[model samples]
Target chain A: MDHLSILENKSIFIIREAYYRFRNIAMLWSVGKDSTTLLWLVRKAFFGKVPFPVIHIDTTYKFPEMYAFRDEYAKKWGLNLIVGSNEGQVAAGMGPKKGSKLDCCNELKTNALKQIIEKNGFKALLLGIRRDEHGIRAKERVFSPRDDNFKWDYENQPAELWDQYKSTAEEDNHFRVHPILHMTELDIWKYIKRENIPITELYLSKEGKRYRSIGCLPCCSPVESAASSIDEIIHELETTHTSERAGRAQDKEDAYTMQKLRSLGYM
Target chain B: MQDQKTKCMVIGLDGVSQTLLSDYIEKGYLPGFKNILDSGFRLHQMDASIPDVSSTSWTSFMTGVNPGEHGIFGFMDLRPGTYKMFFPSSKDVKAPAIWEIIGQTSGGKGSTLHDKYREGIRRPLKSVVLNIPQTYPALPLNGVLTAGFVCPDLKNGTYPESAYNYLKSIGYLSDVDAQKAVEDRDAFFDELFLALDRRAEAFEHFMDNSEWDLFVSVITETDRLHHFFFDAARDEKNPVNKTFISFYKKMDEVIGRLYARFMEITGGQGLFITMSDHGFTVLEKEVYVNSWLREEGLLKINAVRDYYEGIEFGTKAFAMDPSRFYVNAEGRYPAGSVKGSDKKAVVADLKDRLLSLEYDGRHVIKAVYGNAEIYNGPAAASGPDLVCVANDGFDLKGTLKKEGVFGKGNFSGMHTRHDAHCILPASIEPGGRLHIEALAGFMLDKLLIQKPQRR
Candidate 1:
């Protein structure tokens, strides 16, 4: 079979495996191309219906376009959407202006996710994190176990050789499932185009600028590209030397910042 | 490599087919394999994937699943619905690998996230894995690991930060540079032998250092040797024949030593399995899959843009590497003009024609499988409508740009899915004719290896 089929099959298998093995499982949707493609895979895996709830960690600092896209697709896909926020921190004015990018992300994204996990009692949370996206994420396994606090131990990942992924979370501890961890950014875009998957308009080029990596508005930046279409974005990824997260402020703080944030429970 | 043995060890001899090994064993060259057979250990012909490649076959061996389940069909796969290609890594494997299952039972959520919420590090049986294909950026297994082919760097391929230093201190080379091999023939042999020696040493060191349940190490030199000097092994008069046999003899010695050490360590009670992903044969012709499809008026393209971008609408069908053919039905391809109702008919017609394809009176394709027959999973929607399994001598090539339909090309050898040899202890009966997937269950069953504990 073609490479795409292999990639898609493996991911769907992982997602389905998680579906059967883990109870109280929810998918983390960032509403970006990768996660949207993941949602598309969920639909494909489940035959047009998303059996589980989709958790959207709304930091409230997202691009207006992102929120709009989220709402539209959530309704269109008939999604059981759960909006998560660090309401306590958001009320206390915890954001970029109050702290560093990593701190803000922790308070807004990670902590919000932690709260939602506790509130929903989700045992396994499916994510769309890919290995090629960043160095810190490159070390991830398919069935990544997260503590109740939501931190990721990048160093001591389990040995994953066979098709058998560990379903570690029992009763209360958290487990993060990345069905698309093997996919590259280019592969995501290609899948997006193939499935005709939708994304926020922010990714499309406007005035020769496109959001290669999408995140909260204050920290996220677009790159110079004329990739007005998914096809174009895919073409550009073939030869581009710049990392996918080049425009994200959290990454630019320092090389180790991502590793640290990840260690401290940051997505 | 490691003289110390464990309870269960998988010795992978890549590309050593039934025909070649049997022929060599008959000549007293492969005494190690012969010993296994003579000791009442049966060599089951493990059926690999249709377009058997190391990446997929090894994965099947470790995962106990087909490509449809594991999702690794070849060394490189095109991005879904796009013509662009990407090499799949270990993370791409959706199914749990043998080592991962072993690790899962052991404990420690790979993510540090568990450190705060979870208590205790559960120690399962340790698995010292080495040089398995498609396993890159190795994660911490129960024991140690050094990844195999397509590993870009030693540091990235090794688990535990210190393994890199160990490998580096020993002057270990991951793989032989094929280009340099072409430039200097003698240098290639030196590097090949040296890499093999170092890999053996590293595996030995890890095995000796740790007490483990499962140990697997693959020797990929057979594949490399076959790719270049396959004809030499077949032709007795070739200058490289003696050299190839000597190398095979060296392999026999290594395996002999490993077998003896394994017996010594396990007190002759451990299960030792020697297997290969696929067998090797001489490449007779290179059949350009895409160009052939183009000839059949299945694809329409213009050269003004890139290969993928060049595809035009009304493209009924197309093919990818090593015999993956897709019917461009509506809702699948962006510019697809073929109706969904016509897909089966198109696939049938394509299969009929493909089966009839002949090169100089010899059949090019032996069989054409519809997706429904081969793919038995939810991800079948993404697969090719038909898979063209080529005849033994016909090396199927998939490139928009090719010299011709079927003739001489780059390599001297090709991969065959059938006739792959699997040597396991007679105590573990694999029912009858076994496929690569059965090896996993056998490894788990008779070996008494279990997956990681669920909680």
Candidate 2:
């Protein structure tokens, strides 16, 4: 099979596997390329419908367009959208600008996600993480488990051989499912183009600057690019020396910034 | 005192596919490896996950679940119906790993790799790990781990002073230029294999210093080397060079070194597991998915303006990526160009056109759907408005041109679904099946000063 179909088939298989294994499952949607594609895969897995709640951790500092689009589509798509927010933290004036990059992220985004998972008692969470996004992310497993305290045991994980994934985790059931970890940035864009997956306009270059990654507006920056079209983005990736996460501020805070955040149950 | 034996050393090579390894081994190019395989397990074919990349596959090895159950899709996800990126590591997953379970059952988070053996301070069974790809942020365990190649930037070229100099003296990093530094085929391989030898030496140093459970180390040079050299191996015009052969021989020596060290330390009683992540493949052609959308009329671009004028220009005027397209209405698109009837017709027409167009050389589009039809779950709305898949090898290419030659253009080789990159896992004991993901924690857990009962 060609790359895309093979990718699709494998993702579908993964999604199906998650559905069969998890008793209390939820999918996280950041409204980005990967998760959105994953959402589509979920539908395909269940034959035209998703069975679990879609969780969106509202940091409140997100771009206005994101909220508008989210609300409209949630209603239109009949999505069981669960908007998780740390209203306590947001009301206390917590944001990227308020504190250290690490602390702010912990409170607004990471902690918010952790809180939601706990509140809902979800045993498994489906994520749209890829190995190519960053160095640390590359170490992630397809079905990675986290502790109740949300500590990721990077040192000790399971052994995934063939398709026999260890989805059943009794001790720390905070497991993650990654379907498109193998795909590169280009493949994602290609998949998005072929599938017509909806992505943030922020990713598109506005006057030669586009956000390679999207987080709170204050934290995410745009990369220099002429890639206004999906085709252009692909071309740019082929020749570009800059990494995709180059524009992400959190990654630059410290050498192991991402790793530290992740170890504490960040994502 | 009771007799104590040495534990085996297993190196988990994530993203290392056998598909590429067998090709090299079959060519009789990796002679040193032949000797190493003399004592260890060598699978002619090792399977990986669909995407065959790290995130999903590694997790599969760690948790032993399918991608769906693990719920990791891509690096970033969109909030349902919107254009927001959801980072999986930050907000997507919710699973516990075996080590965490073991630690919990035994009490506490265990030890950090740095804390356990900092400054090369080796205790009994003190495992030392470095450059295993995909691991990061440094886990506190009973072993010393320098994370992996992707471990941001601790040091470049030279080894960390905190690390032992055994490998450096033997020439792991210093002996040969890394694959990234060497473009010449022969030189690259030689550098890599020499580096692997150095890697083995480092493992030996740690093994001899410590007298305990598990000792593991990964050589990323193998995966890194294959990525570029796979091309040389396939093309006769660019045949494998002498340096490349030398590197393979060096790898064999490294393997031999590892076995020898194990024998010296523990009388050859410990288990030795060696494995790789996803395999590799050569790119046959490049598929520009976007350009094909225009060819199929699934993507319509406005003639006047080239930009995607959000609400101003109508969605019908242009198509986005494989995700979705926008329809221009009066206030939506930039110029208010497409009006009432035209807007409706454009949306309807585009939908019909996409559903009917022949993406494969012959068959018409079978199914065309927006986010609502395709995905469900919290993030479903954030997904693409429309999802389409062409036949195998006929994946959507984003080029604007209608059609052209297959093997001509941008991408030389790539990874997609179907290519399940195999990973040989590390084992704690001898005569047991090993899973790749369990590698990190396995080394750490094995090195624990106090043995913890399995959960």
Candidate 3:
């Protein structure tokens, strides 16, 4: 077996475990390369069918091409797609500018997610979060349970060893299942190239810069690269030393803000 | 009891196996370890992880996961979809170490929360890690961090920059000059003892200086000493054996002082643990994996004679260091020869041949693991399709420069999968069979408590 196949098998096993474990589970689809590869793995895990909802949190600030890609694949795959948004907050002008950036993120993304979880009663949410994407996420478990009020107790998390996950959530608090938590950003692009996973054009080099990681259009920027094709991206990542999240504005807000957002239930 | 501050320490002795330790203890040469045995729960015999390379084993120990999970298989890994080999750094590790998962304190050791960049500060450090492998170019750990073997140099290996000055002031050496070790034995021993001496100083320096919940320090001299002087180091009559015993005595003293100080700091309420990434054994023969493959008509090469650079259209399979193998699968590589359909049979046949391999009337190879049998992760795709574990005394080498299957190298010792042991607090018994990765969970279970108040 090849390295990619081993990765695929483990991911497929995790996806199957999620399917078997969670009663009301959904996958968070960011339409990025990582999440899309995750969606492909999800499909592959269930033998070409995603048994649970594919939830896309439309912050109303995402790249336009992302929305187009989402709709195209969602329809093509016959997905049980759930497009969510902070529409109420967006209507009241909730964004990075309203008071502090952290507060705005909480209002726009975390609060919106909280509302969706409550409305849909999602007991567990599978995210495409990879440890290499951010410093804080490095500590995340394959199955991370949120405390009451959706708080992430980062200082103390449960011990998940040998695929034995003690998935006990606080009342009304859901579990965050990261199927790709152990993957690096490089692994995602490689997996994408291997599986032919669909991704937004925003990732491809435009002029000279390409977005390494995508979040909201306002907070995300691109790095200087000529990696227009998937092969080039893989080759570039082999030598590239810069972080994937370097261009994320929210990350620049402060080193601690990502932890703060995560604690507040933000992805 | 309620007022006892939480604390724990993991002392990583690079290659001192339970077998070796038992021999040393029988000679009354390891009083420090003897004390640990009398006090704590000795694991008797904990197996090393698969492949049993120092980097992968320590990584498994730290992350509580196998190579398939933590994504570090050996000292080096081939870049995905390319034949290019890259050193696997701590950054390449996909899973978090216990320190990473526990939330690091702000790099600022004493900065008041309200007065500084208030953006992020984790639970005030509960840990200090020093001289551990796969931790080169040390991450900005919450507490102090000084990396171990394969650390590029003194500057890049130590973290927080503050620790760098202290290291520089004492002229602390991070690792032995490995190249120098091979070329000059006398110089190697001198550098080795100096580095060992400084390592203890650094450990003492940090433990005395830093406040922590957990403290870890791994000594790598045992591994290096065994590698160069394995057979002689054990023989009491050998001239260099005195130097070896002297070094062990020095280490025993270091361990004694460290345990005493650490226990004092912990107020008798902490876990003081000791372990090794893997064990050491005599290197009777070195098996050149690629050369063996070429002889078996499995691998073909061109004039360059390099594994990747010399490959041509006719290549069927190849080998990587520490006994990892890969097939030339098309669609995965640009000019890969093997199609996806024949991969299973091809790998299985390869495994069978490897298992049957022998030299000097001895089964040179103990086991051949299909990547599926050993690993399960995304990076596993990029790994060698097959990993061959050699029997004791038969070291596996990936050097394509060798002319035959059997050869002798300068190395006298090689890594072993058995004999790796650990000592944990007596209160914690992980019970039944155990591997190196189990210790991480044991320590985690110890620290599992009411959440630390958020900064």
Candidate 4:
């Protein structure tokens, strides 16, 4: 099959596998291109109906446009929306400015996410993480599991073979599910075009700059680019010297800075 | 004594620590591991061979030899005779793994002529190799494979069509962000375990549906996590922290699930082997080696108009700790500036000065290891003039950070020559630490049941 078909088929398999393995599962919808694309795949996997909830961890710091897009699409796709936020942290007056990037991330993003998992009693969370985004990412497994506290044990992971994924984990804790771990930037764009998935406006270049990665507005910066369309971004990735996360402030703080933050629970 | 013939399904944990595991197990935190230990042997420590890198350890594990004999050294080497960084890959391994020796002779499909044949066939055995370091540009083995860290481009590897379909079915389209998602990762290991589960399921499915003798897989998630999450696991205030205890426990669950699936797929007919390339240790501080070199007069350089008066022109090159420099001898300097005899004297003096100098209120450079002392022959000749093993926590500063500690963009945490960034292998054999090299050997031994002469 062609590359797009190949990608479509792979995502379908992972979704189906997750549906079969986990009784209570949800998809984290960041309202970005990756999650929106995941929404499309979910629709396809379930014959135009997402049988699980689409969780949006609202840190309350997302751009205004994100909410609008999320609401519009949640209704358009008839998605089961589960919005989560760390009200305590926000009430405590925390933002990207208050704590270190590491601290801020944990409080605003990871804490909110952990609370959601615990409160809702989710067993699996479908994320849209791909492996090409970072050096550390290149070392991931397709079916990774987390502990009770959501700590990722990199040293010990399951051996995933072929298409048959082993999704069993401990009693009731949730597992981080990545359905599109292998597709490259080009492949994602191709599938987006093929499926005509709706994306956020932030993806388009504004004044000759574009956000390669979408995060809380304060911490995420736009790179110098004019690739407003999906195709242009793909071409930019093919030729650019900069990394996808180059605009991310946290990564620039230290070489092992990302590691330290992630070890603690930062997404 | 452990039976040598019991089958093993080795799983390599890139940077695991036996000490760390023991500490957690003692606390009764890791139930999955507690179960494994209850049933199998729990050796306290597995002595890792030298040069403790992924490729060297993996090579040694498969060949039952040290990096010295296998010819696979550190991550970067000099191509033959040049002073450059040489990365070890499948191309650099010179010796025949036990798999090759057995696979070739059994079915007459492989030959001793380590040519195109070695690159094309997985020998006469059926193996599934995934994410093993240095096995990039995956040789067309008789089984399946997903290349390791240096596999140039990961998307191009020969993954099953179903793998891609799984990505699409989950609402991830082929977009830049989606593609970037898979690529951009940290020690966020839960996702990695998921990947391994998917891979293992496929492997087990193949093992059950088809007739395959050897099944092998490697995961990079552990190595990535140790580099990133070690602190988070312990950080009480950090919202995203992962404790060292919880991390291994999570992995244990995945391992447990993997074992169950393997048993179901293979009907308990296969052995499992698990291992790590090396082990990991926590770093406490960073010592800038270059700063001390500048302090001593062994090296010469023109400081930015602020420091002491600029030194006269001389031959010198700067690197991290244990700063190394040489007089501009032949084409680099004016003739008679430092005659041949002076060159020898300078070298000797510089060596003594470096060994005795201190930096950062500490003995900056430890005992200096030369090629003859630390490296050997082809490998040593291609390495740095002197391999400086800085004191613990001392790291070599980049060229940009020339002035002092905490340069404008300097961030600390680094790997040492002996830092325990390793894993515990997954094998069906007895419970013990299996080296990365033994992964291949174990696979061959199980697949080729009939003992045969070496290829």
User: How well is each residue in B323-433 modelled by candidate 1, as lDDT tens digits?
Assistant: 788787787666676897898789888888898888899899888888778765445566677887778888887667664577674467888878788888887777777
Q: How much lDDT does each candidate structure score? A: 0.76, 0.56, 0.76, 0.57
Q: What DockQ score does model 2 reach against the true complex? A: 0.02
Candidate 4 lDDT over A206-230, as tens digits, reads: 9998776686888778878899898
For model 2, residues A1-267, the per-residue Cα lDDT tens digits are 889989889888888788788868999988877787788778778886779999998888787767876787677667899998888988999876764455677777778998888788888988988888876686888898888767787667888898888788876567888988877888898888888877778788899898877767787778888889888888888888877765544555333543432321112
TM-score of chain B of each: 0.90, 0.57, 0.91, 0.66
The C-alpha stretches of model 3 lying farther than 4 A from their native spots are: A1-267, B1-5, B104-124, B303-307, B450-455
User: Which runs of model 2 end up more than 4 angstroms from their true locations?
Assistant: A1-267, B1-8, B14-28, B36-44, B69-128, B155-198, B210-212, B234-241, B263-266, B290-455
| lDDT tens per residue, model 3, A129-199 | 88877756767888888965777876578787887877777676789988888788788888888778878
- CAPRI quality level assigned to candidate 2 from its DockQ score: incorrect
Q: Rank the candidates by DockQ, best first.
A: 2, 4, 1, 3
lDDT of 3 at B414: 83
Global lDDT of model 2: 0.56
Looking at model 3, residue A73 earns an lDDT score of 94
Question: On residues B1-455, what C-alpha lDDT tens digit does candidate 4 reach at each position?
Answer: 21223344666666666655666677776776666566543433454444455556666665554454456654434344222223456656655554444345323322232332344444365445556665644545545555555444444443444533443344321111112122444433445545555554554454455334554556655655555445444456754354445556666776666666665655665555455666655444444444545555333544422111222344343342123333434333332135666656655666676666555567655656543564443333333445455555544432312555323222223333443322223334534544443345445445445433446
| Models sorted by lDDT, best on top | 3, 1, 4, 2
Per-residue lDDT for B166 in model 1? 88
Model 4 ranges with Cα > 4 A deviation: A1-267, B1-7, B47-56, B59-89, B95-123, B159-211, B234-245, B260-271, B290-368, B373-380, B384-392, B395-402, B405-455
Off by over 4 Å in 1: A1-267, B1-6, B105-123, B303-306, B449-455
What lDDT does candidate 2 reach at residue B249?
58
